[model samples]
Target: MTIATDKITYSFAEYLELEETAAYKNEYQDGEIVPMTGGTTDHNKIALNFAAYLKFALKGRKYNIFIGDVKLWIAQYRQATYPDVMLIEGEPIYYETGKTTVTNP
Candidate 1:
């Protein structure tokens, strides 16, 4: 289930800080932080299959393939999300020095 707080809104920085220690994945939209729902088994299998295929097809290439766990930071929308699969070619552009958040796909 997705959890959204209506009583209090959080700033982008505050959301990021809270997310670091959050038990579950949280999505930041504008100034609100919402908890993400866990995907079903079928979803996990599909994502894994896709990632495996990409890895095989792009073997020895410069592209990096990430599945489900990496955080994607979208500055224009002020949103942070975890996509099912992401493929980044060449070096990735990070949002912070921690290098845990990526700004480019």
Candidate 2:
């Protein structure tokens, strides 16, 4: 039950380019790239179920629920994470090269 150990290092510029269209998403942090693992079918089902419930329960609220491939940047730690579920409000953030900074989950 371990993620692959190919903790290859990448510069910020290289990371941005790699993220543009990598087959599977990679999480960037501390000058290292950790290949993301695909979740099981059960994981997908549960996530969808939760998302559906949240959407219905939060109808008319300002919160937005994102399912997958959404970037969460934590600028304080210079890392970026892709989370299973994220709720965000207001203008969205985009990584424009190294122009944008990120943080870990």
Clash counts per candidate, in order, are 0, 3
Clashing pairs in 2: 74-103, 79-102, 79-103
lDDT of 2 by residue, 1-105 (tens): 887876567786687788877888888787887788889999999988988898888888876777766777766676777777766664455555442332322
TM-score of 2: 0.74
Question: Which 10-residue span in candidate 2 carries the lowest summed lDDT?
Answer: 96-105
TM-score of each: 0.88, 0.74
lDDT of each: 0.90, 0.71
78: Cα error in model 2, Å: 1.8
The lDDT, on a scale of 0 to 1, for candidate 1 is 0.90
The superposed Cα distance between candidate 2 and the true structure at residue 58, in angstroms, equals: 1.0
Which of the numbered candidates is closest to the native, going by highest TM-score?
A: 1
